[model samples]
Target: MPAQDHRAPPMPVVRLVVSDASHAYLDAVQRQIEQALLK
Candidate 1:
């Protein structure tokens, strides 16, 4: 698996960083949409 590989390790780290950023962005957008709906 890519995660188990110790050599050439940048891929997993980059994937994690990108995933985290996207998740945070999506959460922020969801909150805004919810607020708009409630108003």
Candidate 2:
């Protein structure tokens, strides 16, 4: 219903910035997920 409502105002845009450490952690997690899927 909310999406169908044309009277609603536009939502604001969001930007995300991740640190180097966060990127490394995400890479490690992705590897873990891939290994689990292969098992």
Candidate 3:
């Protein structure tokens, strides 16, 4: 019998809505992800 792969693939889009004060935090997270991919 073949085994199944339980891991799920990453999603293409991650949508989020935040207050003005939280926008900077969200932008920082997005930048981190982008930088990690560049390395």
Candidate 4:
């Protein structure tokens, strides 16, 4: 469970994939992910 929890956030970023995103939401999440990476 700990391992799965740790791996979960990246499943999106690693793929850079959003299953049902509109353009604006995708852009928003991308920026947030980049900020998290920077921190």
Candidate 5:
């Protein structure tokens, strides 16, 4: 359960990929992921 919780955030990236997001969007996502990891 804990492992799946950790893996969950990346799932949204599929949508981002399909949408062809820009670098700024990716950078924001990266920052959120980094903050999550810091917690």
Candidate 6:
């Protein structure tokens, strides 16, 4: 019999910077957050 190793997979990290944003920038930021949550 062999012992099994249990370990959790690593999660990804996202970093971003927004300054003086417009509508497009806000939309992009929202999408990024959604994607991260889905993962």
Most lDDT-accurate candidate: 1
Question: Each candidate: RMSD to true structure?
Answer: 4.8, 9.6, 13.1, 12.9, 14.6, 14.4
Number of the candidate with higher lDDT, 4 or 5: 5
Instruction: Report the lDDT tens digits of candidate 5 across residue range 1-39.
Output: 999998998889877876676767888999999999999
Over 1-39, each residue of candidate 1 has an lDDT whose tens digit, in order, gives 775676568888899999999999999999999999999
Pairs of residues at least 3 apart in sequence or in different chains that clash in candidate 6:
none
**lDDT (CA) for every model shown?**
0.92, 0.68, 0.60, 0.81, 0.87, 0.55
Candidate 3: Cα lDDT at 17: 34
Q: Candidate 3, residues 1-39: lDDT per residue as tens digits?
A: 123332222222222333544888889999999999999
Q: TM-scores of all models?
A: 0.79, 0.54, 0.47, 0.46, 0.46, 0.46
So what's the TM-score on candidate 3? Answer: 0.47
Model 3 residue runs over 4 Å out of place are: 1-18
Residues forming the 10-long window of minimal summed lDDT in candidate 1 = 1-10
TM-score top scorer: 1
Query: Which residues of candidate 2, in runs, are more than 4 Å off?
Result: 1-18
User: In every candidate, how many clashes are there?
Assistant: 0, 0, 0, 0, 0, 0
> 1 or 5, which is superior by TM-score?
1
Give the C-alpha miss distance for residue 34 in model 3, angstroms.
Answer: 0.2
lDDT of each residue in 1-39, candidate 6, tens digit only: 123222222222111223334567888999999999999
Model 4: colliding residue pairs: none
Task: Give the higher-lDDT candidate: 3 or 5.
Answer: 5
